[model samples]
Target: MTQKQRIDAFVSLGNFLRSDDQKLDILLDNASIKNPWYTKNNVRKQLATLSANLTPENLQNWLVGYPDVTVDQTVGIILAGNIPLVGFHDILCVLIAGFRAQIKTSSDDAGLTSFLMQELITIEPKFATYIDIVERLSGFDLIIATGSDNSSRYFEYYFGKKPHIIRKNRNSIALLTGNESAQQLHQLGFDIFDYFGLGCRSVSKILLPKGYDIAVFFEAIEEFRPISTHHKYTNNYDYNKSIYLINGDKHFDNGFLLVKEDERLASPLAVVFFEEYADLAAVTLNLENSASSIQCLVTEATIETSIPTFPLGGSQSPRLTDYADGVNVLAFLMDHATQN
Candidate 1:
């Protein structure tokens, strides 16, 4: 299929996602049962994001700067299952670039990803020739893989020689200036609690000014206390709280989440680490020093920082152009396809 055909296919898929479909709800419900982490609500949240952004205008704007990829290449995609349909963007990138995609679907999220692609083929039968769900990825000119830190080592070792985009574990950070309104902090709660904080975009840590009142944050996020009702989330919260108490560590506990002061970017599930900053420069330097480990920064638009900031609660709803780990998957494909 040509570039316009591919764009139209995705636009149709977007409309399909936006429509009220009883089957889609059933799929999400069944998926939640298969993997408790893929809660129906979380899957729908991502679906909503895709629905909102997959417009013709958004796709056209995103592609305007890039050259049209006329070269035909096969891309091997090893997907991650940390969140519902987490690897869909990579697949979309390959498809939009007019490359054949052989996807190694995550065992945790195959049902939904499989269903979406099948729907795409239904909308545009020609897409069937361009997409495949495989048990093992092979015979591809390039690859894109997402996994944890340890799994990334395996990916690097195996796919090193191939032109590939391999991503390791990354956690987002929220920088607080103590001037945020209750509504913003409340929205930040979604960044922290969404997907039960499993995905890299989740705000695993918060940066606070010294002398900041922790209770203010606690009060604002009280609305999200329902997140604790999940047995999995509750178990993690209980385990982490007990560990802290046993170690005699100083920490603050809300019913659903634990807040502790630590100089770490990645926090455990159900726990959010925080560090008090005496000066913004020190925090900026600290973040810069550890930029590789950080996925994205979340803060108020008005806050001045050396690095770019994502508005509060915007981490999860990444746009089509918001390539993962700051690597443009589509650009990578188009630039390197000639060599392949």
Candidate 2:
């Protein structure tokens, strides 16, 4: 299929997802059954974000920079299942670049991506020839894989001979300059609580100005207390809280979430790690030191830092061009497409 055809099909699929379609609801239910993390609300939220990003204007803007070529190579993608529809962007990149996708969906997130691909084929029958959901990813010319740091080693060992992009574990963080408005801090709660902070883009840590009142931060995020209603989330909160209490570690807990002074970037679910900084220079130095482990940074301040920063609540709502791991996916695809 041509690029326009691919774009049109995706746009239609996005519209169908936004509509009150009973079939789509069933698909969401099935997805939740396969992975409890994929609750109906989280699935819908993810779909809505995907729908917004699939517009004709956005797709055109994203693909226009790449050299168009109709390369007939199979691209193998091993998707990550940490969040709902996590791997759809990779699939979109492959198909839009005029290549075939041989996908091995993460077992935790199998149903939704397949359902969406079938919907695309229904919108444009030609896409049926371009997409395949395979049990084993073999006979492919190149590979793109996402997993934990340990799994990345396995991927590098197995797929090392082929052209590949292997992504390891990464987490997002936020910087608080002690000047955020109450509204901005409230929205920052969404960055932490959305999808129960399962996504790599979710903010698991925050850097606060030294002597900043922690009470203000807690009060602003009070709206998210309902997140504790989810049993799985509550269990994590209770477990982590117990661990802290038993160890006699001093932590601030507001009954629903825990905030501790941790130097680590990746925090466990139901908890957010935070650190204090004296100034922007210290924050920038720390971020630069941990750049490889950070996926994105959320901040409202204009700090001079090399890390990618988004507004307080915009981490999860990334645009079409927000390639994961800071890799230029389109460029990688085009470079391979041009090779004879």
Candidate 3:
């Protein structure tokens, strides 16, 4: 098979995972048995974006640029469980690049991704051997691991000898102009609360203008009533609230979620924080210092200078298609073949 054909296998797997008629809803129902973040609406939304973004055209472009790629190499991924199918992107990336995938799925998200991998094998049987689940593996040519800052230390020690992409915890941020319209602010709500603010890409904090009314932020986010009502989310909200109250820490209330005022990148799952900024230049410097642990940033106000940023609601739905560290995946894949 041609390289594009193999990449197409990855695209087809994505489409199959997203099929409305598939048992995804059922799987999500089972997941909700453990954590109620698997609400039908949220799962459907997640699937829709992931499925739509992996179009045949996009997949073809992804492989076409990688002319010398091989299908025999193996890449290992230690997936993260903080968000649904968070590591699926890396799985598809390696597979589409014509490499075998040694997947160590996070326990919280393994079932659904494993089921999808099974479905992929059905589409093209030979591809089945290219993917495997493992309790322990060491033969991989490249490793892509994601973990907390603590676990990253062990991953670095163990896999430091190999070509690796080891990701530590990171969170998204938002820049507010205070002049944002209600619609723009509402989009910000999705960035913060989607995935119950568990994903690294989810915005955990915002840089608000000084004296910016917290009321506006609350009013905008209240539109996500379904998100607030999810039992899993409410559990986090209540748990974090109790912890804060017990410790005598202060947090602003938005009825459903807590807003803490802090200068940190990541907040607890059910809570968000905001910091007031005096100047954009200072904010940029702070972000630069913290860039290693930062993902995407959202902003409404146009800056005189442009930096890395994403639209308001694009956090929870990055494509299998998006290259990590802003490097072109197809080019990198082909380079491996050329170098060898």
Each candidate's TM vs. the true structure? 0.97, 0.98, 0.91
lDDT tens digits, residue span 174-248, model 3: 888788888888998889877778887788988887888989878887878766667768888889999989998
lDDT for each residue of candidate 1 in 227-340, tens digit (9 for 90 to 100): 878999899999999999999999999788899998778899999999998988778888888877888889983544444368887888888877788888877898897565
Query: lDDT per model, in order?
Result: 0.88, 0.90, 0.76
Local error of candidate 1 at residue 204 (angstroms): 0.7
lDDT of 2 at 99: 88
Ten-residue stretch with the least lDDT total in model 3: 321-330
Q: Give the TM-score of candidate 1.
A: 0.97
Q: Which candidate achieves the best TM-score against the true structure?
A: 2
TM-score: model 3 vs. ground truth = 0.91
Model 3 pairs whose backbones collide: none
lDDT of 2 by residue, 1-340 (tens): 6678888888888799889999988998888888888998999999999999888888888887676667889999999999998988899899889989999989898488888988888899998888999999989999999999999999999998999999999999999999999999999998999999999999999999889898999999999998888898899999999999999988999989899999889999999999998879777888989988999999998877767789999999888888898897888989989886
**Better model by TM-score: candidate 2 vs candidate 3:** 2
Report backbone clashes per prediction. 0, 0, 0
